[model samples]
Each structure stands twice: as structure tokens, then as C-alpha cells.
Target: MPTTNDELPESGRKITVTEAVRLTTNWRTYLDDSECDFQTKAFLIPIASIKNLLAINPDAEGVRAYIGLNDADDAMSGKLVLVPVVDGEDVIFLPGSNGDPDVENDSNVYDRSQNCPPDCSTPNELNP
Candidate 1:
């Protein structure tokens, strides 16, 4: 059975999606941490792409989506889907998934643009 970081052995590492799901059943907490609670909700990662992440970091902790750093007026919000890439004892966050149209065109203009980057001029690039 899979275990959370707090429940693992001294040499244990972060859990992968498969192991995480097997243990938690739901990916909500993982997803939430990645997204960083930016009023935006939900996360989407392709199953196939996970393999590349695994290859790069076999002991990766978990994926997270960056919701932008704090800025003036706290209006600088953007999404950066990431997968954990562990390098030795350091855990790095690697970019994963892309923007969703639904989020980009959300009824709330603030939330809409908040989810998209100003320089993001293209559609989401899906890994086929």
C-alpha cells in the first residue's frame, strides 16, 4: 500500500499518481496543493505524460500547480501545473499540463484572466 510523506520510512520518497491514488483514492489534496487555492478549481494531467515525469525522477514526491507568487493587489494569479522531480534530497517542481479553455473563458473576468498568463498566446499543448 502507498503511504503519505508523513507516513513513510526514513528512506521512503514521495508517492506517484498511481500510488497516491491507490492510497488516497482521490487526487483532490494533491491537486489542491498544486493549484495553490487561487479561486480556480480542478486540475487535469494526462496519464501518458506521467511516465515522462517518472522517468526523470523515480522518487518524485507529488505534482503541484503554481498559482503565481504574491504581487501588488494580489491580482497576479496564473496556473503552472507541475510534477515533482526529486534531485537527491531536494524536491523540485516541474511544469506539467496546460491551461483549460473553460478556465480561460470563465464568466468572472478576474478569474478568467487570472488563470491565463499575459504572454500565453496559444492553446494548451497536449502530449500525444
Candidate 2:
């Protein structure tokens, strides 16, 4: 059976700092071992975009991020697409799909998160 909205928690669970560090460290180690050019350490999504996604529906519980590559041919161009989650299901807005004209500001999916390397933050335990 599928997880119902009522069965889901109101919010996500939290993790401790130690656990967070371990997860990040594991990812870093994997990236190093893989020796790939796409060394994306992190993605920075603006708060405005999040707000916009949330504003799409009043009942939105949260946002779900789907890892994606901007260009299928370019592995370095990795990206994350965010969609609003309502009742445990992704709420993707597809305006004007029924023969009507597309409206501006009718989109719910968001991308363009600043990736690390060029837009990385100052040296920190997570980014270092």
C-alpha cells in the first residue's frame, strides 16, 4: 500500500551534526575514489525559488529535489530540480497543457542551483 498523506509526518526528521559530517565525508571520499571531473560538492538553491515553489499550493508539505544533469552529454553539468511535495506526492505544475496558452509564473519546478567549484563557499569542514 502507498503511504497516505495522513500517515506521513507533518515535518521531516532531523539529524545530528556528527551524522551530517559523516554523510558528507562519505560523499567526498566516494567522489575522490571515482576520480570523475564532475566534482560537485554541493548545490546552493536560493530561498526565493523555494518560496515560489511553496507558494504554488497552500497545502504543500515540502519540496523534493531530484538529481539531474543539465546536459546528458556533459556529466559535469549536474543539477537538481525541485518540485513541491503535497501529501507525500510531487506536485508538478504544468500550466496550459490542455490547449491553453502557457502562463508566466505558472511553473513549480525550480533549478539553477549554484554548484560548488566555481561558486563554492569559503573553506569549511563540509566544503573542504
Per-residue accuracy of model 2 over 1-128 as CA lDDT, tens digit each? 42654665656555566888899999989989999777888899998887766666668877888888878887667788998888798766643544233643555678968777568889877777
- Model 1, position 52: C-alpha lDDT score: 60
TM-score for each predicted model, relative to the true structure: 0.30, 0.76
**Candidate 1's TM-score:** 0.30
Question: lDDT for model 1, on a 0 to 1 scale?
Answer: 0.43
The best candidate by lDDT is: 2
Badly placed stretches (over 4 Å) of model 2 are 1-13, 94-106
Every model: Cα RMSD to truth: 14.5, 6.3
- For candidate 2, report its TM-score: 0.76
Candidate 2: C-alpha lDDT = 0.75
Q: Which candidate is the best by TM-score?
A: 2
**Which pairs of residues collide in model 1?**
34-64, 34-65
Off by over 4 Å in 1: 1-38, 69-77, 85-128
